[model samples]
Target: MPSLLEVLKFLGAGVLGLTLGVEGLSWLYRRLKPAGSSRISEVLFFPCESHCMESLFSDGRVSGDQCVCGETHSTALQSSPVDPFYRMLSHLLSARVSLDICVFSFSNFELSRAVLQLHARGVRVRVITDRDYQTIQGSQIGVLRKAGICVRHELSRSVHMHHKFCIVDGRLLLSGSLNWTMTAVQSNQENVLVTDHADIVAPYLAQFRRLWEANDPARHTHSPGNADTYAPRHHGHVHKGHYADRVKGLVHRAEVEKHTASNGHVYQQ
Candidate 1:
């Protein structure tokens, strides 16, 4: 019933109203969304070295580094179905100085191969694991031992050395519910937290040292072919000095040693 000009004007106003309403709703939604909401898909499996390596204890408070201690970042494959094995491999491939690992179980060949490759490239690699799991059919401890990677097993047969953590280059720490196994990577529900916070890394490093020293290879006897006869191409012990320097500011040496001593009574298998 309206004239042509009036009809056109009415339609134009309706279109303009709809556009403005949509824009307003979008703005409100964005304003209400939580921080890091957009980063939900960026599962954190490794520290971004350039952005995360700065010490967090500067001025006695957490620094501006992207990877802050206690600010947990997680990686999982169960819901998304991504290849967690390769994701973990990518992290190991980034190690430059050292890799310290403590896990309850390990059998994934691809992950073990990545670790062997890292050792071959001159990274100092050490592993602490459960004795029972080490003897499993696909366990990689034998492969690691044959390659001269220092590996130790828990001395206590009753208690399992159930820890799933790895420290890379003394700066980044990876820990979570995930075990180093094919089932964990391929189908099991698992998660990994990666960070470069020195405080978090220090305790784990101390624990690893305790376990490593307790399960000293010199004190234990090995089968004829089990001894690591291959001397490293480089002076790998020098890397330990580098690690010491890295943690000096974050954790007191004496404090760590005391902590280690207090818990050192636990025998390794």
Candidate 2:
């Protein structure tokens, strides 16, 4: 058995290491995400802003008509596809039994609004958000639970949970780079993999459970700081039956269209 002082020292060192590691990784990520011809995961559906909607909706060989996800096609404006993000939010709002969200931070207005709506609908919304930004994002926690959403903070060393994922009805999951923040939807280069596979969703569910259980008050603590001052900048193939191309075919698309450059490597724009 170790002395209490030794245990404390070890814990302190571990926390410091986690912080440094995250900062280092973030720097490297900034370097690699330049725009060029580097191939990425096949995009299925993504949000389009003002400029690309017109070009994207034009008829092409792969798609007989304009992409259905286009914002405008003819005289009348069209609706965007209900991508995974919207689908997940819709399901959450419609959930009668439960809604589980495990995100590093919970600050986006749209996302928070959806949670509140779900609460109003009598759905049990449980959230596990990062404690680092609790002071900043924490204000909404009380508001959510007051409306009936059950929210919890993950008591971990890292400033970020570093995982953006959600599971719904034990049947569907949305996981990947998209965080519950304004930039993720509006400007950042991010992608989320949505799936209906229980096997993949199981591990994430287990991780959330373990973290939630480990959140004992006496075990973790953080020093007070200006929490609101910082805005921390932060796949799969499935087979379907043959001959039923309508039900079996898959669509790939890009998530964000931002230019990035690195040591001669360019990514999608």
Candidate 3:
């Protein structure tokens, strides 16, 4: 029968062997890993409260005060731990030419700051958010608007502009279930997908353009609840097209119905 000391020795040996085996396997995997696999993309999760992303700047590389994203890095204000949302902000700050953002909520202060920084850097920024949320307490929409950023919100009361996406440079795309709010960033579970795949990005770019045109304050002049009357926003020049013709036809039909109803006659389309 083995003594107590022998039993302890056997257990210790087994643990050391297992650890060594794992280390060897990891080394081999790294050596054999395929190239370009790491370039695929990145999917970052949120709610990382313990380790804020400020750590990424711990080496004093980039700082906002200098007005740089990949422009420069700053030293850690907190600790050397990577936070995912802040990582996302870094990517957002890298925008060079344009950023078209469409989202439901816009109350996140850090995000607002990034957008403002981009704008100050001469990046063309367009923001489309929910009409209702634009007035909510702590909303950054008003701030963006006050800064002269082009902001167009949904005019529908029943439906909302719930898209959370931003196209960067007409190439890179950022979209996901994350909301630009502190609660969503610090507590709620969220995910952000960042990709620059052309095929995938092209569609989102088109969608943004469509929404931008559709929500143009000029386009909503004739819409219900809008105070401004319908008029061409661009120097009184309306784009002549099928949509223009359709809008005119609908307005005419509505007027005819109203007049007929007042006279007790049913108007036919």
Candidate 4:
């Protein structure tokens, strides 16, 4: 076996070489693609628990569409519905002007790949997350920056940018409580909605811009002030603490629904 130092040196060299190669490829791709050529199109979504996810990640093909007589027929690609995550990846890859993302934590391999793919395609991608959670995603950000994506963190000390959102080309907005974490998709109850409406996208763009524009401060220096004070207040308790008033509110709503159901009148919760 090689000496310990030699093995370490070899591994270091391999990592350095891979990083350089990815950066070089990204540079070449940017040189070839003209800027501002891609346009914003329609947006789509799939509920986090949608069965479509299994089909998307499955190795087996759907074959074709079933006709009225039960015969499988060739289906047009354009009409085929898209998986939500794939649609998100497609938007990132097709971005010409910019791709902006804000999340709490991102460790999913597929998401990282999409970000790298878009960066390699020459689209400007910017990511912002909580400072405390940055180290959890440091490797991903390093890969992103090396591929020419600008990455940063939220400056608000108390809030931690609990928001999960993305803006594609400044025209498309994705928002909700769904963070880029695996649990959020595969287990935790979460929600996300994509909207092409300017009214929705504009405000989120502004919010992201506000957070992005803040200067990066030195660690252990900044103070988290009344920033969290604005958070919604609640009376219910949580496992970590009485925090997450949002979830508390959801629980309260559930109780109210149960109370109403006990009555004779049928009502929607």
Which residue pairs overlap in candidate 2's backbone?
Answer: 34-260, 34-261, 35-260, 35-261, 35-267, 36-266, 36-267, 43-252, 43-253, 44-253
For each candidate in turn, the TM-score is 0.53, 0.50, 0.61, 0.51
User: How well is each residue in 138-179 modelled by candidate 4, as lDDT tens digits?
Assistant: 236556666767777654434556678888888877787666
Q: Which parts of model 4 have CA positions greater than 4 angstroms off?
A: 1-79, 137-139, 216-269
Best by lDDT: 3
In the range 1-269, model 1's lDDT, one tens digit per residue, is 89999999999999999999999998887678664454222244322221121121121133444435453222222224244444455667679999999998887665687788889989999999975567655678899999999888775433678999998898778888777776666455667876665556789999999999876755544435534211111243323333344344224435544564687531111
TM-score of 3: 0.61
lDDT of 3 at 45: 88
Rank list by TM-score: 3, 1, 4, 2
Clashes of 4: 0
For model 3, state the Cα shift of residue 153 in Å: 0.3
Q: lDDT scores for all predictions?
A: 0.64, 0.53, 0.71, 0.59
- Which of 3 and 4 is the better model by lDDT? 3
Which is the leading candidate under TM-score? 3
Runs of candidate 3 with Cα error greater than 4 angstroms are: 1-40, 50-81, 222-269
Query: What tens-digit string does per-residue lDDT give for candidate 2 at 1-269?
Result: 99999999999999999999999997887566654322322232334232222222222122326456454332222244344445445444545676678886565665787777666767666787765444342235556756766666654333356677877765567777776765566566677776654446689888877876665443433224532122111112222322142122111101111212223322211
Q: What clash pairs does model 1 have?
A: 154-268, 154-269, 155-268, 155-269
lDDT of 3 at 16: 100
